[model samples]
Target: MTKTALSHKSASPWLEDMRRRFRTLPFLKATGNTVFLFIFFYLYLYIQRNPVFEVTQIPATQLDRWIGFQPWALALYLSLWVYTTLPVALQPDLKQLTKYGLHIGLMCALSLLIFVFWPTSVSAAVGPREGGGMFAMMYAVDTNGNALPSLHVAAAVFSFMWLQTIFRSVRAPIWLRVVDALWCAGICYSTLAVKQHLLLDVIAGGALGAVAGWLSLRSAGRGKIAG
Candidate 1:
């Protein structure tokens, strides 16, 4: 076979193996779902403990920290900001949708779970504060039970980390990755700038997203492509 055809065949075995395991490997098939369930179970038990919000602070007085533009932090936060889709858009397929859903569910559930033991703050300080357009609304609707995990940031970073899929599937340019990385930074800053979350919250969110994204992506198997 030619090099191109040989390469394709080489790739096909791994793809076939992954697809076959989807049936034989229940854990593989439902890794995302399993994660979602654990997170949900954790939250279910956690509520009995009753979470509370505590206080924390942003590091900078002049606005803009992340330890003065922490690289990964900036990339994760900005990618999330640019890529977040509106609720009304055309829905993704079941597999992709489930991944996204599980990511969100896991973040929110674990965050709430963590809060029961180690509560953190909604804002840097407890006070009457000026709020922005969505900020006030988010604050009002936001549960006082959990704020530290910054589920929004977690979800954002989850999607950002999935950027590789976009490139792999579409043959996207390298600049796209760079753009997504920049968005990650913006999303993190926006969390603090908009008063949605603190620095610690951003860190926790990024970490959670990283783990969940890794687990979800590792198990995503593709079916055959017609020649």
Candidate 2:
């Protein structure tokens, strides 16, 4: 009985120490960026839901259709970035939150502009015949509005190229960077597997994300975080 009591006492100190460490790192900052991100996400849904934003389906041409194949197909992949970035945003006062919000805002602004000016949609329509593929859950993703500048590919490309600097200061080793890279790569690939976006959209998204990520890292400061 005494041995059991002693073991409990011994671990209590370590557990308490861990608790203290965790308490230092909060989970959410709830800053302007947080509010803005929520607002923007809502606005995205609103734009899609509104009848004002019509879904314009594209006609299939031979060259454009062939984008479905390999070599070219590789560029279309983008799932991991979609899933992972939000989780990162959940972390507390990382400063990167604001940076991310800014980049995301730029994407949204660019997309919104495209939506307004070009006002186009994908040629492919996911209807009753549309398969229950990776994006099956998001089947509502019809060819109505929201087509130009694929946010998925853009975000992944943005994160991959930009966050490398941030991760370098992350205090992790080479293996961790490699793992993170794979995760980023997966995010890029997942976009296509899910079929939520097409090749043209992905390419545009990549460009936007890349530019945004670059600007974000630059604004985030010279790779040196205080405290």
Candidate 3:
């Protein structure tokens, strides 16, 4: 009986640490959210490409015209996937992970709903992806639909906001924040530069992302207070 009691006492700290680590696991939640959003995004693309929907081409504004076409921006545009995946490492707690996933899920849902009901396409001429290179591959997979509210921009904005919060929580350096901010801004501009979205689409996407980010943060705060 004395030996058993001593063994249990020695194991208690290990058990408690395991529990803490389990609660803080962010990769599973982030991966789950990523898969779900991608499937839904594919569905949105299908709906947009369907011939049954009345696809209205959104005309570019004067601002859109001013935003020159820069094919090199494709690198920055594709970097959004990497930017979004950073949360798996940066999220320090279950609360932060929850908020990040919720923000992305909500952002995708709202953007998809708009795409389904009010389908829009880009009117501006995007240079042909004819070389069968990286850009061609991207164009092949990424259908030209869901144009009004750029999900790319929305995702970038939502991701950066959550990342900012996470950085604050971890007391990350100011340089990290600056780099993140610059990256996010580059992603936003890349959308326009690549001709994937117009100026208005970017504006609306940014607004939606901001609202969703704000809501997610508010919800997380309330949860903390209630707890």
Candidate 4:
């Protein structure tokens, strides 16, 4: 019961609790993901703004014409931020959580590399959106040159693929799974409806996301075998 020992023993419960929570898997995963996102965003914005790389416009296919402009889809499109992060917070264990984080980081890195080598932009087919609102604001900041691999679509597809297993493990109802699929589908379509990406961009991004998700799951499976 030395003086310094007694003082340390009486440290505030609030501070102790905060420290404990920050050590949890969810908190650490979130912090790491946030940092990665910030760095990725900086690089992405830099590429978009760079004037040296010539922008290649992706042409619209017949399907792109059928999709049409649905300015309303913007809501679902932007929901990607939530959908992408929710699963990480709900992760059941540190081991699985780490795997998911690895997958996401790899996917983002691969996309960034592609953008550096081949700077592609959405075609002017849809032209400039004609009003002032959320959509307009998005257009203002979301410059061209990030097309070909639609990160938005990739994220939505990735979220859907990974979260499906989580939800099923929790015994969520069939209806919930159906809604999840629909939401992801909406996000994929939103990329086209708003003309932020062409049909080809969505396809390529989806393929990339699926591959990443598969590889991540495979790695987790191998870990279980080793254990």
Candidate 5:
């Protein structure tokens, strides 16, 4: 067989296996994601509206200034909600699905706690004018508080880690893995490009996400998803 033909043959089984998993308990997975996300947003909005501590503005770094505001990045920034659902939706069984939830939930809980205690906000001058359009709506609803350890970046990173593990376990193609990485990177960059978060916030959020994802994978006693 030609090398290209051999490669395709080798890849077919894993691709078929992934398709079977996606067909398992589809309704339950969708409901779980919807309910958990609703709860998360409720808590997040409540904390944003009522901070326990005095709100502090996050100071911008030179890096923050260097990355100019890009209005187009709002698409990537908002895409985090959809991106996060992928990991949970792909879980092949209830056990793995629950574990994913607990780990991600804990990470989010920690970030919310920090938001309540520290209560940080980004300066209004950093981003686009909130006079009208989607930016105005986002600014109106998601007002700057909960700035440090941005849950947005943290969630994106956490999802990326889980997706990476799942993809590796299924022996997914290299191109699929590249798309996953690029999507995650775009979400991270969007947080800054949209001026919703400062450099320190993104750094801290990335660290928090990496640590949580690493610990979750380690404690699960395996690096890849259950086959």
Candidate 6:
């Protein structure tokens, strides 16, 4: 057989396996994750609008100024919703999906609790730009509260960790992993680029995500989900 034919034959099983894995529990996973998103957003917006304590302002760093505002990065910032759902959609079974949800849900709960007691916001001087469009609508709805430990960055990193594990388990290509990393990085960067979060918020959010992802994977036996 030719080398091309041999390579194709070798790659077929993992590709088929990945397809089968993704096909598992599709409807159930989508519905459950969607419902969780709605609940999370409702709680988040409620907390944002009604902070019990004085909202601490997060200071921008030189990095923030260097990155500056990029109106185009809004697409990357908003892509976080779709990015976060990929792992849940690709879970191989109900047990694993449930476990993933629980871990992420707990992380969000902790963040929400922190929001309640120690609310934070972006510096007014560097807030989202003024103008009518998606940015205006986003700013109107999201406001400046819940700034520290950006849930946007946290969710992106959490999804990144889960996706890397999933891809490794399926023997996905190295390029696929690189794309995953780039996507996660873009989402994290967008938080700052759009002036939605400061440098400190991104750092804290990344830390929160790493800790939660590590704990979740550890509990899942290093991402080995039994059939």
RMSD of each: 9.8, 6.9, 6.9, 8.2, 3.8, 3.2
Q: Clashes in model 6: which pairs?
A: none
Candidate 6, residue 76: CA error in Å? 0.5
The lDDT of each candidate is 0.53, 0.54, 0.74, 0.76, 0.85, 0.87
lDDT of 1 by residue, 77-111 (tens): 34443365411011124455555565556566666
Q: Is candidate 2 or candidate 4 better by lDDT?
A: 4
Ranking by lDDT: 6, 5, 4, 3, 2, 1
In angstroms, how far off is 135's CA in candidate 2?
4.5
Enumerate clash totals for all models, in the order shown: 14, 15, 0, 0, 0, 0
- The residue-by-residue lDDT of candidate 6 on 1-227, one tens digit each, is 99988877787665766777779998898899889989999999999999899888777787877877788999999999899988888788888888999999999999999999999988564644655699889988898689888889999999999888888887778998999999999999998888888889989999999999999988987445523
Residue pairs whose backbone atoms clash in candidate 5: none
TM-score of each: 0.55, 0.64, 0.79, 0.82, 0.91, 0.92
* Cα RMSD for predicted model 3: 6.9
Task: Give the range of the ten consecutive residues with the poorest summed lDDT in model 2.
Answer: 67-76
| lDDT for 166 (candidate 4) | 58
lDDT of 3 at 16: 41
Predicted structure 3: lDDT: 0.74
Indicate the TM-score of model 3.
0.79
Residue ranges of candidate 4 with Cα displaced over 4 Å? 1-26, 222-227
Superior candidate under TM-score, 1 versus 3 = 3
lDDT, residue 181, candidate 1? 70
lDDT of 3 by residue, 1-227 (tens): 69988877776453443344345665675667668767976787687777356888887788877777778898999998888776544554666666667667777887878887888878434433343487677777776678878888888888887767756654457887899999999999999887788887889889988888778777777334222
Query: Model 5 over residues 92-210: C-alpha lDDT tens digits?
Result: 77787788889999998998888888899887446554436998899888877788998888888888988888888888888999999999999999999988899888999999999
